[model samples]
Target chain A: MAKLKNPRGLEDSQVMKMSYWKILSILLLVYTVTGGFLMEVPRLAIVNETIRSLYFHVPMWFGMVVMFLTSTLYAVRYLKKPGAYFDIISVEFANTGLIFGFLGIVTGMIWANYTWGTPWHGDPKQNGAAVALLIYCAYFVLRGSLENSEQRARLSAVYNIFAFAAMIPLIFIIPRLTSSMHPGSGGNPGFNTYDLDRNMRMVFYPAVIGWILLGVWIATVRIRLRNIEDKILELEYEKNH
Target chain B: MKRIISIAASLGITFTGYAQEPEMADGMRSEGKIYVVVAILAVILFGLVAYLISIDRKVTKLEQRLNDGKPR
Candidate 1:
């Protein structure tokens, strides 16, 4: 609340425009690092030490899903309004989502290497996640192939929406339907069943929020960079003509 | 010595939980092993923040190039 007012007492509308992602992400990073490990966890068999991986690994998937959802929302808007701004936002969100998704896979593999005995076991969730990311990867390839900006935006927007739709079943539904080595799959109970203690929830929730905010902040930065690049290109075109 | 035995017992590696002490992930907590993980994490986090800062600097340079360094 105190940050609402300008420190210089100048009448600047930039006050409301600036985001708090930078500061909050740093704070939450500190909170997650210290609190995540120090807190008590449910003493379950096989996943005793690796339960802490829940804080780091699960948040990546959560952040990726949230960022991809945001990307799809913008893609829909681009289809409706047909604006370059929306396209840029959509692409940046996807880019950030890819980073989170990639990190999710890496962390999951590391966790799995210890818990599941293999990095790339044919778990339904793992296979599903891989397919979802592959779909998103094709979206980027689609964008790069097109030369005309408007056509690229239109086509990519459509593809992005479809990718997000398909990813839902891959990530959430199919994992639950078939057997999975991961928790909360097939007949196994979810962590919530054991986490009635709520010891991990305190840090886990904050970790999710923090990672999502960090993704948004990175996307925002990329969007601004895109805008700058667009402006510079426009200026060069004018000078050449 | 005794701690490993208790941990092994508690995790049902040798015996069961009732026969041993409470199960805690003493892997990172003991013998300053936690500090190694802490250091690795700190370095990774620092590297990411540094990368972000570099991006911020690049953006600032671009803004200055586009706007002649004047406030918009």
Candidate 2:
């Protein structure tokens, strides 16, 4: 790649870091929006055209899970080696994950309302997802209540790992163990049974990647903001002392 | 007359239950309105991406300033 100079004088490292993945994210999403609609889909009775939502709605959950997984890995890294940067990265990833989770729930509800005949069916997956989100919500609460920075980071990193562990069962395992209106649960036919056509897979996989990349992109931006804030605080402390 | 009308409506519902083809937005797609929907959503997605990129650039600029020890 040619080293392009920016008028704003951003270093090559910073400029190049965001170059390829960002462009890929945009392109994949644009393709998702177009292909997701126009592509051939399995025609089922209740789902009907709403099967198209699989492209948009399911990706939110996939993105959320990926974000949370990334957050947890960073949290573990923070535990292994205490550092402000790792803490910031962990927190930002979890924050982005929470946003994706919220979007997933809202979109799920909308899809459920049309197909399942009610917004909240007390379905296992629905309740599981809600509980998982609340667990993560408490993580932020825990972080907010702590007064010391080191203690806050250490405690919250632990809590983040716990939250991710709890989320896996709540969203994935528990839902599958019982009856669920959600596909692939309680012996219900899943996407593989009918809807996972080659055409749909083409758009679906890209959508998942695109959404996950977008979430990571947002998390990285927030991490940068936190770093800047930390630097300013450090500079101020040094000057005062 | 009311009884006859109720019977007809019930029969219609029953027939719909056994309808051969599932209902879909074929009319909308055929009329090209689905493209309109896709276009609007694409525009919104692009707009958000652009905003995020701008923020990313601004953050890079701030980082540069801080690295130079010239924090504005």
Top model number, TM-score: 2
TM-score of each: 0.83, 0.90
Q: What is the C-alpha lDDT of each candidate?
A: 0.80, 0.86
Give the TM-score of chain A in candidate 1: 0.90
Which parts of model 2 are misplaced by more than 4 Å?
A: A1-17, A187-190, B1-18
> A182-209 in candidate 1: lDDT tens per residue?
7766644455443455878888888889
Candidate 1 clashing pairs, residues 3+ apart or interchain: none
Query: Candidate 2, clashing residue pairs?
Result: none
Which ten contiguous residues of candidate 2 chain A have the minimum total lDDT?
Answer: A187-196
RMSD of each: 6.2, 5.8
